[model samples]
Target: MKPPIAPYAFIAPALLLLLAFGVLPVVVALLVSVTDLDLAGLADWANVGFVGLENYRELLADHGFWQALANTGIYAVFGVPAVVVASLAVALLLNRSENRFFRALRAFYFVPAVTAIVAVSLVWGYLYNTRFGLLNHLLSLVGLPPAQWLGDSVLVKFSVALVAVWRGTGLNIIIFLAALKGIPREYLEAAALDGASELRKITSIVLPLLRFAILFVTVTTVIAWLQLFDEPYVLTKGGPLGRSTSISLFLYQEGFAAGRFGYAGAGTLVLFLVIAGATLVQMRARRFDADH
Candidate 1:
């Protein structure tokens, strides 16, 4: 009994830190979401009376918040799946032929993931500049009109999405490559014996086995997209008539920039719930397939 108690005691410190740092902040934020707290009232703890979800009500009525929500949805819907497919294709290519050049190629894909996002955004902004940009220069060579990549309201969101796809596709490729390698060679040989083509074997064997990895990639990518901030914040600044503003950017502006702390908290909470629910649905679908 004493030995068992000692092991439990050893785990207590880390658990306490997790509770303090992770759990407590979430609870406090939930409480803050129900109030009318602003920067001027920050020091007045006693005045922070519960307003019983008026912040949530206000968010529902706010057109700016709704616009942000729509932009975020569009980003997630288009951007995440495009990244997933591109990454999977790259991973499939790299997982084959263990040549030194291919090994180097694997590393090359991940360089963007480890690079500073602000620096990457700055370089991309220059490339997206209407007049002197590399993208426009190439298009000019082909006699196409120089289109405003980041400046036009209609094209800004798609431009931001393209940047996101470039940066995000690498991580998912690495994950899918690892999963592909984990697949046993015996299955490939067996499929070949049955006169199965590469495409048929991949469809029948490889994909079924890689389901979990695919599910994981999809869920995590969706979660990241839901919390999209840095790229849009740095590149577009929610500009071109607020066409590229995501929910997270909107929340940041409301909470910190405008000092509408409670309303921002409410927006944050709504985002949390949306991500949580979406993840749960994906997990449940996976569970159902496993059961079947």
Candidate 2:
């Protein structure tokens, strides 16, 4: 008991930091969400009053908020699967190759993951310009019509999703590669001896064994999709008739741009709850799978 208490003493500092940096801010934000606090309210305390659920009600009714939610959902629907499959495919290919040169390939795939998103977005913005973009120029070489990539409302959301997939796939590739390498060689050998094809082995053995990693990836991708802001902000500015606006972008517009602090806080809280619920569902599914 004394030794256990000594271990807890070492953990105390990290726990304290979490409370100060994480817990305290969340509590303060929750309190702020219930009050009608704006910039004026910050300067003059009497202007702030308890507005209760009004903020939440207005947020739910707001068309911009709903559009943002729909856009985020669209992003997650397409982006997550594309990233997951692309990453898994890259990892599989890397895992099978036996050359030192292939190790360099891993670095190439991971480079975008570590690169600054702002810088990448700016560069990609130029690449997506309607008239003189590298992509459109290349398309012209193939006798294909140039697409108004970032300027068309119909294509903006999908275009943004493509960018998200391009940027996020690298991290997922690394994760899946790690998981693939962790898989026991004995399983592969045994399956081979049983005359199972590579595809069959992957379908029956590899995928099932990699279920936990899949769950983790899914949960993280969903959360990241919901909080999408940076790419759309830098590239599209939620433009092309606001087709690319995400929930986080909407929250930023309300809180910082529009100065509707309390309403933005409420929206943030709602988004928080949505993410929390998604995480909970993932945990429950994982638990159920483990039990089975």
How well is each residue in 80-113 modelled by candidate 2, as lDDT tens digits?
Answer: 8888889888888888886888999989999888
lDDT of 1 at 85: 90
Error in Å for residue 168 of model 1? 1.1
lDDT of each: 0.91, 0.87
Which 10 consecutive positions of candidate 1 have the poorest summed lDDT? 1-10
What TM-score goes with each of the models? 0.93, 0.93
Best by lDDT: 1
User: Which parts of model 1 are misplaced by more than 4 Å?
Assistant: 1-22
